[model samples]
Target: MPDAGHPAAGAAGGSVPHRPARLPLVLLRSPWFIGLTVVTLACIVAVFTGPLGRPLDVALNLVLAALDLATAANAFSTARHFPSRPVRRLALGVGLIATIYLISDLTEAVGTATGLLASQETLANVTIVGSNLVLLGLLLRYPTGARSRSDRLTFWLDAGSVLVGAGVITWCLMLGPRREGWSLEHLATALGTAVLLAMVAFAVVRLMLSKRPPLARAPTIWAVGSTFVLYASSLVHASPELLLRIGLADDLASSFLMMVALWTHRVQLRLDPDILRRRRRKPFSALPYLAMAAMFVVVVFVVPEGLGMRSISALGGLAVISLLVVLRQLLAFAGNAQLLRRLDRTLVDLRAHQHRLRALLDHAYDITLTVDPRGRMSYLSPAVERTLGVPPAALRGSRWRTPLHPQDARNLMRAVPALLAAAGTTVTWQVRARSTDGTWRWLEVVCTNLLHEPAVCGVVCNARDVTESRDLHDRLRFQAFHDPLTGLANRMLFTERLIAALTEVPEKPVSVLLLDLDGFKEINDVWGHHAGDTVLVTVASRLTAAVRDQDTVARLGGDEFGVLLVGTDRAEAERVTERLERQLEEPMALDPGPAEATVRVVAGASIGIATRDGECFPDPSPPVDAMLKAADAQMYRRKRLRRTGGGRQTGRG
Candidate 1:
């Protein structure tokens, strides 16, 4: 036989070895061949032995031998396929012992009454029993491909029970003739009783301890228990007090044991009735249980008692039980075959789905991830590898909070529970994540809790690196609020500040100073707008530098500027406006001087002060507009005073 690890000579590499075609047919695998051979041999033996008497017993012996031969051959075949050395040895040893027992039994059957009690037969039986014990031990202790701990334990118990039975037979053969009824030397009766009691006790304990709910609660246990109890009760009745003691006791014990065995068989059938039903449904392996049950029913209902029908019925019942067991096994084999096919299809579908999802994720630009309710990452798309430069696998099985920026991590942790509770709500935040290149990248993540969809099952976050966009937005917003020419507050922003100051100073005094450069138009016409703009910008900077930081300086329009003095009294506001005017009046050295124009331009301003009483400025609008108009009127009055040779009034108008 070829070893399990070795390939057949003509087979391709990595392929399993094929069984040799010339080997003897297997009873289980090639049942037709073995069945036919056994039946033909039994028929021949029965024909020669005559119709009645010992012909049936001779045929039974032949059938038993055939079964033993088949078991031995299969054991050898299985031994060659075993990968473990100890298991192989165990199988081979069992096969050898079985072969020996088969030969001895066959020899005894042929020799009939003369050779049945020979020493060779006894030795063969003992060897077979001993080898089976060794095999059972190996099966229990050693791990096999298909056997579990429970299966091993069951095998050990079964083998031990059989050994106990064989020991009883051996004792009976050795000492049955040497003593009277119920004597110690009538060992068969005593040992047989002991074996029956032991078997029932073991069965009860096994049934009670079994993890399988069906077996643990099975009625078979009670049936077997009653059988042994009945037999033991019959032994008590064997005394002279009971009439026709031996005959009645033997009859009752045998009948009760047979009935109990049959009942146990029926209970097993009920426990797994589908097994027989399924077997009948199959085309190749039909229900042997149905046939067996039919035979038992016929014998019980129709057979006459005078023709030794009781013995025939008992034999028929045994056959029925065996057939039922075999049928159930066949159904289990079919179910396993169907399950394997379904598993293969499921695996194939799973692989295909995985491949498609992988492709979609790998090609996407956005970094997508799924997080659990605890804010731990459950899944990350492949795009994370390309976008964040971090492999998806690397981020898997890690908490999302760990990857967040330190400043944001605490807030994110707190938000997780709330987000989970809200279900469909989306939360957005900016976080920093470590990239594959070991640099931190700013990620704007929008996470939506998909609690609405059972399939979604997690928080889905779609993140993108928005650093460039954020920077651009900040720059654009700054430009919108500030003057591009001078980089100072623009008209739009100055108006907003004016409104804010008026609203803020409900009881406090506030002032607005409006300044316009004197003779600025002539300077611009001669020196060009570019030179004029440079001068205006210079003046605005000086004004900004002179004022307190809280004060506002803005280029209101062409050649006009405004300042809103916060928290200032009328005196302080006058002093600040004077200081700004003086700074602007300072001579600017214009570039490209032929120095012919040689001009020193004086810049002056009009000041307006607004102090809030309880009712003077009741609304925000009037106060802000009035402040600017007052400042403008004061500036005109001052310019007229300067032209008329009147001294300039610095007081608030």
Candidate 2:
């Protein structure tokens, strides 16, 4: 048998369960692993060019050529998979440019070493310019889906700036080899360089001002800006006098660009952890390190006079700084990864605890339910069957209105939609439910919305059967308002009747009759309290039969009783009182063969009347108490008159 906690196994009638897809281990590690390694190695090679000399230079060039080729191949492969035609074309353009650059670099290295086709060096520079222009155009033409018009314009401007930079490089290559005095190539190179610099400055300003997704833009601008500044400053350094000024700028720009590249690569890797982790292994960078070492060697061996020492020192410092920054970035990456892992573990533990708590709630006696904003049940606990005789499965996906009594359903349906609108609030109401057994049961329910929670994703209702308790409470309430011994309205109920009558029909003439059964205490003393109870029950029945149903007959303790008659005049009250007195005078029957010993009990009752204007009694202050007091006083006066030999008078004056 399978464990009850686990999802039920698929059988003839069981539901098939879905399993979550597992994340690949490699995907979780880093996103820019390949890109970062390539860029870092390239920077190292550039830095060490002065020390490593010919062999190291050749090796670094070969490495660069290989990386450029790989980048082109990868770009083409990715382009083939892209959904957008424009984006695919742009990607293909970038790949082609990269391929051209790779070939040029390889041929340039060969020509430099063998000294055979030295003319190709200038051609290689031209090829570099053409490739850069093509790459920039591709970057501009790359489709950014559904961007604003302004963004499209800005993208084009930025790409144009990069193309302008390529034009400057082309001009410089044409002029540097010719060295002709004041040539068009030389002037054009300076002008193009100035234009490119201005464009870069504008782009930087835009970057600072714009409030867009900074992740892609910030690093891209920083890398391009630093590269422009470094190359421009290097060109400005012609003689010893200009060298110091330009060399400082060159050093600052180079160092800044390297640092920026390192930081940007780290951010990209962190942002996309999956791509970095999928790599088989980190690429080697020994050639770049060797190239950097050789750059230092060349600086030491063949030192150019006038500010060469300062240039070498600056380059050395930049290389050291770049190395330190790379190490720092790596450490930070590792720390962030560790934190993410810890957080994931904590979340797993929390989910486990939540499951255990849910298990406990599922078995609880009280019916627990979860609903959506539409008031449809999202979840219903097992206790639904025990409490309402409704299965949990039957309740799920059903609207709450279905289970409610028809009379109550209309109001509940109206209220629930309004309640759902105020999500995260608690709403409570008493509802009559139609049980599975076809009986109506009252349930006190409290609903709370769980819409605020990302996981809970719905509203929850906690309900329990309160029918038995409510019925018991109502019974006790009824008993409080009636005399337990006689089953007649007690003082409390009588008072309520008198007040209601006084307020409702004050001008119509209400009579309050206070009755005392003569010799009732003597009868109780002669007989037991049980016999007295029997007599009281008999008296109650007689009073009920004598008075109109609208009139109230109450046991006001001992042998005293009270009645409230609505719309009765003083004459009518007198007639009613005379009849009640005559009926009591004739009654004397008891149980157990009492024809000879039958008690001769004569009972008499006194009555009092009061009338007021209906308008005056609109805000009647304790009207029942005032009426009862007036009746009591009059009843005493009549009793005194009878005791003093006053004849019974039936006429009302």
Candidate 3:
């Protein structure tokens, strides 16, 4: 950052020495400035020494005309270079008003030297009023504080008073010019000048009372120079008409200083303008005031003006005006301080509320968060460490999305916008959130848009771990459709499967195979139900191993099993039945109990096969019971054939 006085500080803070503008350097560097200085010097010399001849006076008039053009160029430069918006605008406004003064001066000068016009009094009057108003505007725009809504009415009212005072004084001065008491024109001009100086004093005092950067101090110092020249030109003079020439020099000097101030500030800041840093407070400097006063005293002696009663009264009036200006500034600053304190307190309270609200949100669920309108994460509650295994600090500004499970992230991205656009509605969904340990857990999230609320101007989302609950639900659903003992489809499930296969077949042929364990009831009566259960489990495993993966095996009842095969013809069904019989008749090892030794068990299947195709399959689809009844009758007939025949006879047909 550049120094405080520089625009790089933003006219805000810090301290830097105020550098005096080198007017001589300006005179040397710019031909325009040098030319204006020479013309002004000639005019000043003419004011003191014009007794040599009329030619000298005519020469002085020409110089005055040249000064008009020079001053305009000066105003243009000042307007362009002025740093802040208010100052730039004020300078431009002053430049506009100064143009009127420039015109009037040039007219009178040209009229005197070349005899171009009859009278220039009207132009002169306009100059006097217009220039003073412009000066008044500059003072008002000086940095003090911005207007607040509460003070706006009062500010306008005060401005109205200034207008009224100017009007009354101008009217009185105009009347006096016609009557011959005090010249109305001179008094009006003096009144305008006085009010303008008072405004400058107001700005100066306010600036002095506060902590100001050196840039700020430069203006105040220039204002003092202006006040000095304005007062000295008028106070020492007998006629206000005679004071115009000297006053013109002062006004020109004022504009010159303003232009220089702008240039110096810009140069100090360099490429990085420091306009935003705040100004710091410092003790008031009495040296500049003392130096100016000393300078003023010397000018008084040189001009040889005695301190008369009128002079005393004038001095007293100027002091009173300055005092009133100071009083008004003090009140304004006092009000500004009070308002600043209130604003600070409000900010503190807001911070406190934010802290408390966050604490509550952290403990509300496994993880809570807020997402901005653009889907950026604005807040992440502390419980994220427990739920998502993410640290609280790690998930700022949409970073939470980075660790989401791939499929879940896609789901959230698609769902978030639709949820926010729901407007006052809440959406709940389950997604898999990846943890820090690289495991994915299922989370059920409830999300709501609270964008309209001041406290939460984003979407509030609360998520809880639901992986355990989901797993439990799946297990319960599986158990409802599967047999507990053999881990196959139960009788209830087998009936449903048979019905579905019948409806689909002929399009894809269907076959059902049912079998009973031969002599299995004798083993159960001898060994116990536990040994029988072990044999059944062995039979189920073998049966599953024998068939195609697409086939469904079910324990239909005690020692009875069924297989519903879809997309199979009669040949395929016969081959599968032969495989199942072989696997079941093989030996099986059984554990009766912890107290008992292991038992060897064997079981053979008495098989029955039923088939359906386009011809045999009923058009409306045969009932599940009809299919089961056919299989059961065939199983009984096979059982009788096996008993009649010898040596584990195969009765599968």
Superposed model 3: Cα runs more than 4 Å off: 1-335, 361-365, 370-379, 388-426, 434-440, 448-460, 491-519, 556-566, 592-599, 606-613, 618-653
Query: 359-414, model 1: which lDDT tens digit per residue?
Result: 98778878889875444577898878877777778889787766667777866755
For 37-153, candidate 3 gives per-residue lDDT tens digits of 666666666665554434554555455445544445545665575566765665566556556656666666667667675665566557766676676666555564425643443
In the range 431-473, model 2's lDDT, one tens digit per residue, is 8988878888888888875665667756678889899998898
TM-score of 1: 0.46
User: Which candidate number would show the highest lDDT if scored against the true structure?
Assistant: 3
Root-mean-square deviation of Cα positions for candidate 2 versus the true structure, in angstroms: 20.1
Question: In model 1, what are the clashing residue pairs, if there are any?
Answer: none
lDDT, candidate 3, at 260:
45
Q: How big is the positional error of residue 49 in model 2, measured in Å on the Cα after superposition?
A: 48
Q: What are the candidates' C-alpha RMSDs? A: 23.4, 20.1, 13.9
Measured with C-alpha atoms, the lDDT of residue 164 in candidate 1 is 36
**TM-score per candidate, chains pooled:** 0.46, 0.47, 0.47
Between candidates 2 and 3, the TM-score winner: 2
Output the number of the TM-score-best candidate. Answer: 2
